[model samples]
Structure formats: structure tokens, C-alpha cells
Target: MTVTDFDFICQILRQRSGLVLGNDKAYLLESRLLPVARKYKLASFEDLVRLIRVKSDEAVIKDVVEAMTTNESFFFRDTKPFDQFKQIVLPTLMAARPNKQIRIWSAAASSGQECYSLAMILSEMAAQLSGWKIEILGTDLSTEILDRAREGIYSQFEAQRGLPINLLVKYFTQVGDRWQINQKIRSMVQYKEFNLLNDPRSLGKFDVVFCRNVLIYFDQPTKAKILNNIAGLMPNDGYLFLGGAETVLGITDKFQLLAGQRGVYGLTTGQAAPATKPAAPGALRA
Candidate 1:
């Protein structure tokens, strides 16, 4: 593709999704959107861009955006966060608000593995949380991924990644060569197509928010804006889990690192709560 075509496509992606695409990422655009181009019978990437520029078609635009948005995820993809969630965060929340309902938001919940992982944890602790109401909301920017998330099926390899043998046996049923998460676990979570850059306050407040591995895509200002927006939708003591490589430091003062809880952040003082350091990567098993 020409420089002009690449620049135009990159601009559209950033405007719509807050994804920063440097000049070096030409290969990414080509690889990811090639299917969209071919499906539309466009002769080349240039043809795709030409059609996009002229028609500004909603379907075409949506396809392009979804294709470009990264959806890489796995069951309990990173270990520490889930460990902190089950051992500390969940218990703390339960004790802090006994007899109250609890909600979790997996903001970048691609394909639902993260949300389902959470469901499995909650299910394991069902006896402890018996009388309380709980729900997991998995939101993504791609409707295509959300649809698959709702289906809750995984390939054999997908089922194995970061998933323990016992839990797998208990929670999934084999269908042909794939595994389908049981209805009991699937029922605990809801999937929605949502954009983080947009206002999410209408969804109501959450007790914990998992926006892991998502903010790395945005520029600083956009990152802070999204962080502040998330803060607005969480309670004063709500928990936030970022990716292993992500942190609220140097980004926003809205959240403080929870003491001794690696990858787990809480509200700061006054508007927020105290936060501790996160654990080292790969410290906890899934």
C-alpha cells in the first residue's frame, strides 16, 4: 500500500479505537485486514482503502475496526491477577459488603476466557458466597468476538491453556474436538460489545474492574481519560486489575496501587484508596 493509504487507514483506526499504529506496523494492517479486503473482492489493500474512503460504508468501517482490534486472550492468561482475585480481592469484597450484590467488569474481555476463568473461581467458592448475588460482565469492542464469547466454546488447545485438568473436567463438556463451558459457569457472565473510549457510566457501578492489557494501546491522554471514566463507574473501594506490564503509575491519580497486591489496584486517598505493589510476573499458578 502507498503511504497515503496506510496513513488514512491508521487514522481511522486511531480515531475509532484509540489504537496507536506507527509507520512500522504496515504488516499488521495487511495481515489482519486482508480477509476483509478479500471478502469484499477488493483487488488489493489499495482497493480496500479506496472503497473505504469513497463510501465510508458502516459495515466496511466496522469490519476494518474489528479486524484491527487485538483480541489475544486465554484462560487465566496471566496467573498473578487471578491468584490475587481469588485469595485476596474476592474475600475482601465479600467481607466489606456482606449480604450485598457484587459485580465485575472484564473491560477487554476478548472471547470470554478471562470472564469464564473468573466464573470458575467463583464457582469453586460457591459455598462461601452462597447467599450473595454475583455477576461478571465481559465487554469488548468487537461484536464478532462477543458472539463467540457468549457461545463459550473453545478448541482443545484453547481449553488447555492455563486451565487446570481438574477444573477442566468439572467445568467443560467435550463436543467433537472442542470443549463447551458448562451452563452453570456460562450463566454467571454476560457479554456486551462496548468501547472503552465511550462513556460507560450507564452500565452502573462495579465492585471490581479488570481493564487489563487494554490501556497499552492508547496514548497518554486517551489512557487517562479512559482511566478516569472507569473510576467514575466504580465505588470508592472498588478494585482494578491491569495487565502485568500495565500500571496506574504516571498515568492517573484516580487509583492507587493496593499494598502488597501486585497487579491489583484500589482507590486512592479521598477520591481513591491506598494501593500496594503488584506481585512479580508468573509468581502465581492459574
Candidate 2:
């Protein structure tokens, strides 16, 4: 590709998804945008660029951002964070709030795995959470993915990839070669289409927000903007979950990292913090 075409792609991606594109990432542009180009019957990347530059079509813009987003995720990814939530967060929340409801949001809940995993986690401990209204809302930018999420169907391969055998037997049923998530677990979560850049007034508030792995693709400014936006929707004592390598220390002062849990952080209301940020983040894969 020519320097001009590469630069054009970089500009478009940065504007739409806040994903920074160095010249070295031209291959990434080609890989992600190739299908879009082909679908539009554009002969070349330059042709796609011409259409984008001259037309400013909203469909092209949406397709571009959707094409670039990384949708890799699984149930109970990395394991540790869920364990911590069960051992620490849940107990503390139960004790402190007592009878109050707990609300959680899985912000980048691609294909519904993470949110369902959370449902299973809570369902297992539902006895402790009785008289408390527990709700989990999962949102993604892609409507097709949300539809699949609502259907709660998964291929045998997809189901076995990250799910433990025991949980698999208990929570899923064999439908041909695929496993469909149980109705009870499916009922525990709600799915919606959301754009993080858009206003979040209708999202209400969340006690815990899991927006992991996706931020690494965003530029620093976009990352800060999203972090601040999410923080605004959360209460002062809420919890924020980032990817294993992602941190709030350098990105935004609105959140303080929790000690001992690498991907977990606490929101401090005033001068006081609930728990310390994790000192070392364990190697986690999403």
C-alpha cells in the first residue's frame, strides 16, 4: 500500500474507534479492512479511502469500527478475577449493603460469555444473595453479537474451550453437537446494543463494570475519555475491572488500583480507599 492510503486508514480508524495506527500497523489495516473493501466491491484500499473521504457515509464508518474490534473472550476467562469477586467483592458487598441490590455491567460482553459466566458465579451463590435484587446487563456495539448472546447457543468447541467440565455438565445441555446455556443462567443476564462514545445517561449506574482487553486497541486519549465516562456512571465505591495488563495509574486518576489484584481496582469516594490495588498482575488471557 502507498503511504497516502495507509495514512488515510490510520486517520479513519483513529477517528472512529480511537485505535492508533502506526505505519508498521499497515498490515493490520489490510487484514481488518479487506473484507469491508471486498463487500463494497472496491478494487483497492485507495478506492475505499476515496469513498470514505468524499462520501462520509455512516454505514462505512460503522463497518470500519466493527471490522477492527477484537472480539476474543470466554466464560470465566483467566479464573482469578471471578475467584476474587466471589471471595472478596461479594462478601464485602453482602455485609456492607446487607439488603440492597447489586448491579453489574459487562461493557464489552462479546458473544455473551463473560456475562453468563458471571450469572453462573452468582447463581451458585444465590442462597447468600436472597432478598437482594441481583442484575447483570451485558452490552456490546454489535447487534448481531447481541442477538447470538440472547439466543444463548454455543458450538461444542466454543463451549468446551474455557468452561470447566463440571460447570459444563450442570449448566449446559447438548443440542446436537452444540451446547445451549441453561434457561436459568440465560434469564439472569440482559443484553443490549451500546456505543461507548455515545452518551450513557440511559445506562443507569453500575456497581461493577467489566471492560477488559478492549481498551488496549484504543489510543491514550480515547482510553482516558472512556475511563472517565465509565467512572461517571459508577458510584464512588464501585469496582472497575480492566484487562490484566491495563492499568488506571497512568491513564486516569479517577480510579485507584486495588492492591494484590492485578486487573481489579477500587473507586475511592474521598481520601479513603476500600482496598489496596494489586501490586503484581498475574498473567491473564482474555
Off by over 4 Å in 2: 270-286
User: How far in Å is the alpha carbon of 162 misplaced in model 1?
Assistant: 0.5
Model 2 over residues 1-286: C-alpha lDDT tens digits?
Answer: 8898888777777776667777788888888888888989998777788898899898987888777766787887877777667666677666666558888989878899999888988887778777888889999887768888998899987898778887888899999988999999999999889977667769998878998887887777788889988888887667888888788767888887765556777775522235633223421221
Model 1: weakest 10-residue lDDT segment is: 270-279
Q: What TM-score number comes out for model 2?
A: 0.88
Candidates' TM-scores? 0.94, 0.88
Among the numbered candidates, top TM-score falls to 1
lDDT of 1 by residue, 38-129 (tens): 98999788889999989999899999999999999999877778878877777778878865689999998999999999998888888998
Cα error, candidate 1, residue 112 (Å)? 0.4
The weakest ten consecutive residues by lDDT in model 2 span 277-286
